[model samples]
Target: MKTSVILNQENLGSVLSNVKAPTYDRDKVTTSIVHIGVGNFHRSHEAYYTNELMEHFGVLDCGICGIGLLDYDRKIYNILKDQDGLYTLMIKELDGTYTAKVIGSIVEFIFAPENPFAVIEKIAHPDIKIVSLTITEGGYNLNEATGKFDFSNPVIIEDMKNPMSPKSVFGYLTQALKLRMERGVGGITIQSCDNIQGNGDVAKKALTNYVKEAAPELLSWIEENVSFPNAMVDRITPVTVAADKEILKEEFLIEDQWPVVCEPFIQWVIEDDFKAGRPAWEKVGAQFVENVVPFENMKLRLLNAGHSLLGMLGALHGYNTIDEAANDPDFEQFLKDFMDVEVTPTLGDLGDINLDKYKKSLIDRFQNIYIKDLISRICLESSAKIPIFLLPTLKQQLRNDGEITRAAFVVAAWCKYNDGVDENGNTYEIKDAMSDTLIRAAALSHKDPIAFLKIEAVFGELVNNKRFVETFTNTLNMLRINSVKLCVQKINSSSTSV
Candidate 1:
């Protein structure tokens, strides 16, 4: 048996010979970015990239000061704090091999709830050039129907009332920007690494709208001083499980409290616009594009939508993880058809990206046996995901009279999955922000077939579309009688793309 060493700065030298540890001097690194919502994805993607830049390109100025803004963030905050902001990043390769790297980019972590002022002060610091966020799609606090900042949120209301003692992300950002303006600090970029399309633009609107109401004086300063640049980020990072920890301790001889595991593939396509300055991340593999829309569209439509398709259908079929469902021949075929028939036409110009190769790679990635991406993780906050990832392709298909069968089936699968019981009669918790509403509508679908679709917040005008309604209704009815697996096979074998 190998000797196990706790993963921290002190034990970095004692780690297994194969494990890659940060070679840079930790004390010499300084924070140029204050990142909010330091979750698995943030650690696995943005922090990983920054660590590479520092390690390979000698970019020490771009070190990150991680901020945890949520109550759930306390867990990670404690872990990273204990380990001195050091954690293992286990990359599960497609060939079923593992590569371990100790990431040291997150030089410090601040739990916002402990001292909100400390968090604000860090963002306001002159050395901080970028305030980055990985606060998921729903965290933006947007009115889903209006596609704008929601002032009606109780948290937003409370933050607006007591600006100094703020709770929400925007409130903290606004207060920090106010301080920055007062201190004559130069402009900074607010970079959003969320999966939302035009994420930076959304961040700009949400922050500016909040500033417009809460601190009208800061609006002009923000307009001139702040920049929000859109980015397209891609990686398959699953939540860390106990087995991952065991593997680290037993196989790698590293004891990590919270280590992140992900697929080897990673991509970051950022808009080439930054106000203050940015790390030479392009030296490390990040693509800096003039426009990220074309790339963003390809990812959101193909990769993201494909994940949702597998997740919803996989859950209903009683599969516990994405790989389990993706490895199924029937499910694999359905995903390919969905990508080729329904989603492809929606993507107009992808510049030079080969759609066929991209789609094939997506299938291969999903079926990676080493990356045990939980179905529940993919299904989590799906109400927010479906609208942003899958709905646009669906709307485009409806307008062009293209293939709607696969997309409609995925919606039906979502309705069925929300019932909180799979075909095997095993109950699982429906994890979503709109869980109650979704379950209620899904339960009502048994009697009123269109009840789920009538959820105006989710389906919107799609409920009014007769062809979509008929197809969705039929699929939902078929699902009620047949197994999810059977329905998938039928959809795959179907002659028409109706």
Candidate 2:
């Protein structure tokens, strides 16, 4: 097969020119990993890392075959197809180190909406070793309150009724795995790159449940053969805007269909449990750990938690991006105190990365002006994010009966944001799907204060935990009186007062 796009080696050099190579041509690449949801994050982080694997380490068996589980992903598939599966990843560094590297890790791109059977066939291909995902937290079709598969969801029902027309990613993955087992293809690693607790395990459970309900044989087979490796992936990647496109055009001198812009900081820690042969990803700077729980806790509690706090606070304070939030002295101090006092105590010591270093990196990443990670992007799905990022610390504080003033501040801020208005009294569109439900819930809670605590979907059964409920009620009352800003000030004053 002929290559689609040509890059001039003379002008851009051999190192720079091979970014747009076609994957279907067997001569140019070897397919080892299949990645679902080839969005900006996967393109910038995973694909860039793989490109480095080929360039620096000389390990050439890894190439990504991109698969999309949604109709919206078709545009990205076409963009990558036109460029022969190459796109530039612009990594914005805080220390004045800017890089624009074209990555060619993905050789073939297919959209499940238009080509569902093709995706299933590709998954059952003998040579494909790793099946990875970057589908967001909500993509797994999990219940926000229960942290498990919501079998009652309409999509789940559709998938159960029509397995061949599998709508959700979870259903499609199960169907594909069934094909692999039936066709006698060996086991493959199911690696999840989403930012959820036990992400890989969650993926395993969801896929397993779907198989068990729809096809018991596949579930049994997966339990015996498939290996789901838990991982922690971190990088601040924002949705690409028109101005971002203009920046890419000026910097790289090429028009990319879906260019990714991200902060320089990126980390991937995986549990070494692949059943099949895998890529030497460590050669490309991936970390393999015996247990990833400590690392996961640190990232989830401090970094992820702080990001959520800052995002809501920033939006309330009339800021667009994280850098703007970092610039506010009050917001910056609030974040520092929240991490230092409340979040740090909850984190039971990470191996090499202690609380100090982790806290510093959180502030530094937030302060990186070049990345422009929008506060609005992080503000979505507070109902989902609060449990993973904020609830753990809250639960821990309650157990210890420790001073949780700052933690209360975050809860109050979320409640305030849930009111669906900014500090300026200007109403912005609430971007969450549960906006109407949450708004009514919060308003009703304001009527009786403790009444809102009854909504277990958002608060979970933890609302009955007396210590947590007491601190939370006090903090919410303070917020309503002095506003979120003053509530944060009081908490920081009491928690970290020197």
Candidate 3:
């Protein structure tokens, strides 16, 4: 596996000859953004956009400085740091073509766990104008029941007691803001690239609440200064397995520890309300809008929620990949039916989108063979995802007195999948933040049929709603009685009335 083409700063000349490298010199780019939780999604989505911004329009100052906060991030931090914050990014276009580039947008990376003090100082630095996050949906530390920051959580409680020495993101953010206040640096936007609806509001609420009790003065300062802009970020980036690493080594002769592979399609709709300055992302196809809600809703409900629908039902049908599931006639019809009948009716406020065309695009995205997006990856954190991506659809449908049979079926499939077994008795491990509780409830639901809904953290008010309960129970019973294909047909046919 040894190769002459090592992926480092010095090999830029050689790497450029093999594949695309940054057109702008690496030394010219300055860091203006400090992104927390710099995972693969961030690399392929936000980082790629920033690189485009620089390459296309010479917007070099907005380069990102990636920071790793959790203990698990130590390994990634070292890997990226060793490579001098350089890595390969390969985008697989839907039509069988590909684009490969060494992304140099991330000018620096700090392993924050190694030195929290230094990390805080870096975040508070005047050059860092924006603080973004791709910390996943669960990383916000919000309590599922209240939808607010869970101060009662141990890490929050610890941070509340000892504000100087902290643990969670809230603590670090509060401390950084405090330092910024003392240093007289202007406010910076805290953008959330996570999958939450109104993520800006969620971030503001969580950060402000944490500081409100711990340091009221900081809360006041935050209220006057900070901005959390809601954003809708999309790109299908799967986990990089060993085979992906080998593709880089053998095909490109570039030995990179963490190279990102993703779909060519990318979109970022951000609200232009940065307290400090922001990048000219619009020059490179990013939309800086007045309201991101419509876009967020469209993407979350249609794209994300539809992905969840495909995921569990796909897993149950013995199809592992999204391509496999989305290609199947029955599953595709079921997907279109769910999106059109249950989801579209609730999404009237999406402006002028051709609903049918958008739905078709979604199916095409799902069926992209190169991405090979795992239904399991889409299925991860269902307890968190259901409420964020799917439950809103359920709530809206119930409010409008609309049909929710397929929507109910989607939730029921999740409950069945939570049992850790597919229809063929092929057991797969359940992975979720609420796995312990959800897995136990999934087992109990086989007998009780309503036990899964009782997990108030995930289900919220829907747990006690009689109408939803009855409909959900019917769907679960139908799954147990009939084959998955038959049920898909029922869902598509509208024969299984609510």
Candidate 4:
């Protein structure tokens, strides 16, 4: 198929006229890898890296066959198809710098639920060596209480029974594996790019447990053959907006169906284990490390956790965007103090690096106005996010017989925000992240903060800890009476604030 340049030299005459866009033959592209979630994050981070690999190393053998699991994702599918699976990615730097590059790595797009058989056949194809996923935390059938697989979830059970439905990522993958095994096809690497701790292990557990319960023979074959490589992917890609689209079209003179804009900084670290071999990603900027735990911890706990801190607190203060929250003096000081007092000590040595420099860079990243990271978007799914992002630090502080007052303040502020009351004491709709449970808990315990924390699914074993229970209960009570800002001020000014 002959491809035409969407934005030619005449269209974008001067602003970006000197940029020499790389070209690729659509017919030469082959589906060597299939990605489950084709969201903006995946397109900006992994797909872009794969595009660079092909451009620099001349390895166009691998092209992503995009898969959309949810019904809502059909819109994304349609948009990409309109563009012939071609899109431009704009990388925004903290110092007001930007670069635009057109990505042509996705060869074909498929909706798994709409056409299960076709997705399965594509996965079963011998050339598709790797199947990577970024289906978000909620997509996994995890029990809310223990942070483990919810074997009892109805959707999972249905998928387990009717594997051809390919209702879930695990179901689609396992079903494809079953077909591959029957046809004597080699195993593919299961790579997870989610934010969960030990993400690859979690993916492995979900798939293996499901297969063991549903088909023991398949489980045995998977254990013997497949490799689930743990990875850490870092790039902040907020959902696109009209203004962003206008900027792209007016400034760059390109009509992108779904343009992805993200921070220029990107990081990908893998566990160096692949069953059917992998791309030469390191030739670009992707990092391959023996141990990904340290890097994962540094990103998850520090960057992601800081994002949560700004999110809940930002909402409580009536700030719409993360950059807005960073502009407020109280929120700014609260975040820095929380980082210095709470998060810094818990993090181990990060590859002989300066901790102060990392913290400075993180702060600067949060203050970017180009990408309006919505507070509400970040605030959703606190149940899954808080445990991985914030709780470990609190637990570590407890182990050392130290206080997590500021950290406790974050939890209290979040609970108050989840109470279905806005900063003005007006009711607002809360979406996702245990909305019903949190709302009911908040309304029922309007006078008692402890009642809200008793929900086992959200708090889990952490609520039962004597020290944490006392600290959290007291902090919540104080915040309920004095409000977040006042309570935080009191804590920061206290003699034993840290």
User: Which candidate number maximizes TM-score?
Assistant: 1
Off by over 4 Å in 1: none
Tell me the RMSD of model 3 versus the true structure.
1.7
User: In terms of TM-score, how similar is model 3 to the real structure?
Assistant: 0.97
> On residues 202-228, what C-alpha lDDT tens digit does candidate 4 reach at each position?
889888877877677898789877888
lDDT of 2 by residue, 1-54 (tens): 222323222223333342343222324678889999898889877887887777
Q: For residues 1-498, could you state the per-residue lDDT of candidate 1 as single tens digits?
A: 568999889988999889999999988999999999998999999999999999997888899999988889899999998899999999998788789999999999998889999999999999999999998899998866567787889999999899999999999999999999999998999999999999999999999888889999999999899999999999999989999999888888999999999998899999988999999899989999999998999999999999999999889888999999999999999998888888889889887898899888999999998898999999989989999999899889989988899898999999999999988889999888889999999999999989999887677888889999999998999999999888887888885853
* TM-score of every prediction relative to native: 0.98, 0.92, 0.97, 0.94
**How many times do residue backbones clash in model 1?**
0
TM-score winner between candidates 1 and 2: 1
- What's the C-alpha lDDT at position 217 in model 3? 84
Error in Å for residue 318 of model 1: 0.5
List per-candidate RMSD values in Å. Answer: 1.1, 3.7, 1.7, 3.2
Runs in model 2 deviating more than 4 A are 1-27, 95-97, 496-498
Best by lDDT: 1
Superposed Cα deviation of residue 47, candidate 1 (Å):
0.4
Model 1 TM-score on a 0 to 1 scale = 0.98
Model 1: lDDT to the true structure? 0.91
Q: Is candidate 1 or candidate 3 better by TM-score?
A: 1
